[model samples]
Target: MKLIKYCLILALFSPLAARAQQPAAPAAQAPIVLRPGDMQVQARSAANRPDRAPVYPGGEQALGLFFLEHIKYPEAARVKQLSGMVVVTATVNVDGSVSNPQVTQSLSPECDAEARRVVSLLTGWQPAMRRSRPLAVLIQLPVPFGTAGHMTVDQARRQPQR
Candidate 1:
């Protein structure tokens, strides 16, 4: 009877003992930060070539038309025609998704807002890739707003010291 009781007790505690014997999972690891020098070294080691042309979603003219048609031009701004370029920095993900679209340079607030709006609305493009993987590319778009011969900010600023 004692042997049977001991067996039952052992059976009951066997699972618990087994669980306890197993090693505990290691603690979560912290992310690593790469310094500028490390990044430079990594870049140098990477097999990136300048000769290859970057892939864009569509032709420049088509893209420009898309921007022109879709973008909301600022109507409130006194000057309608904003005549410079918008430098957009976009991160093209592996899945061909455009993330972190930002305006690096702008000529005017109206132009900037329009460019930002267009860029934000842009969907996943066929990202330029090296070795069949997507890569981030900087796209500079020269957006010329055709308005009645309006004075530019620079022109206004440089108005013969009136």
Candidate 2:
């Protein structure tokens, strides 16, 4: 009877002891491979004469002014007399189409959204060129917004000190 009891106890604890002694499994390794050649890398350039001219060279300035006149601050945004500057970076394709419009700086979420919306509506730009052929080129535009009394730094500087 004693021998049988001892054997039963040993069997019950043996599995638990074995589990505690086992080493953890090693983590799986990710596969690695070399990439093939022939991948083309695209380079972005600014719009310049002889290569390409701004579709709306002076028009970008006009668009900035248009926003100042048109966009009204949203009440829900708690932005009273909202004012900030927007820097739009875009690639003008060879065919004079604007692509990859990016906002480099943002003053407020609403202002940022509005800037993007306005830029998207712009069309009929002169495409940039590489070697006299139309190619994608990057351009940047800075836009300012504000209400009366909230002047831009430049505007403030130009004002006579009181």
lDDT of each: 0.62, 0.65
Model 2 CA deviation exceeding 4 Å by range? 1-50, 57-61, 65-72, 76-78, 147-162
> What TM-scores do the predictions have?
0.50, 0.50
Query: Which candidate achieves the best lDDT against the true structure?
Result: 2
Pairs with steric clashes in candidate 1 = none
Residue-by-residue lDDT tens digits, candidate 2, 38-100 = 433336533354444566745755665666665665564444655557778877666666677
Give the TM-score comparing model 2 with the true structure, all chains together: 0.50
Error of 1 at 145 (Å): 2.8
